[model samples]
Target: MGFESVSDFLAMGGHGLYVWLSYAIALVVVVLNLIAPLRTKKQIHKEQARRLRREQSQI
Candidate 1:
């Protein structure tokens, strides 16, 4: 389908709100999927460092 102008393209036959909202939600899910693992890895590394420090102090 061809749109006569940018406004019409964005309006998306009056379904724009639903379509855009779905895209926004999917984007958020994708971003969270990428961030969660990296955050977990960082937390694990921090805990391991703390444990190493404690062990060294005991030596």
Candidate 2:
């Protein structure tokens, strides 16, 4: 609606590259920030579970 055509939308009067790049970077950072914590938590839980199993086997 704001643009006249596909080319116009993509061009954004020559500022499209900067605008799109910023959006892409922001999306990547947001996704990584969201996923990294869950991955870390999973790794920690796995390590602790393995340690517990090893200790139990030793006993």
Candidate 3:
């Protein structure tokens, strides 16, 4: 299972579209999995800070 050239590797025995699309989807899922948690944490921290400010102002 060896490719003599880059084009051969990319073509992937005529299944290139499916293979590449699957890889692209997997990569996007991995990226989103990473980003979603960080985004949620940031949003939570922002809300907490606002809550604290509101509490302090009430005193």
Identify the superior model by TM-score, candidate 1 or candidate 3.
3
Top model by lDDT, which number?
A: 3
Model 1, span 1-59: residue lDDT tens: 99999998888999989888999999999999999999999999999999999999999
lDDT value for model 1: 0.96
Clashing pairs in 3: none
Clashes of each: 0, 0, 0
Q: Candidate 3's C-alpha lDDT?
A: 0.98
Model 2 stretches astray by more than 4 angstroms: none
Cα RMSDs, all models: 0.8, 1.5, 0.5
Q: lDDT tens digits, residues 1-59, model 2?
A: 48889999988889999989999999999999999999999999999999999999999
* Better candidate by lDDT, 2 or 3: 3
Instruction: For candidate 2, give the lDDT of residue 37.
Output: 100
Model 3 Cα lDDT, one tens digit per residue, 1-59: 99989999999999999999999999999999999999999999999999999999999
What range of 10 consecutive residues in model 1 has the weakest lDDT sum? Answer: 4-13
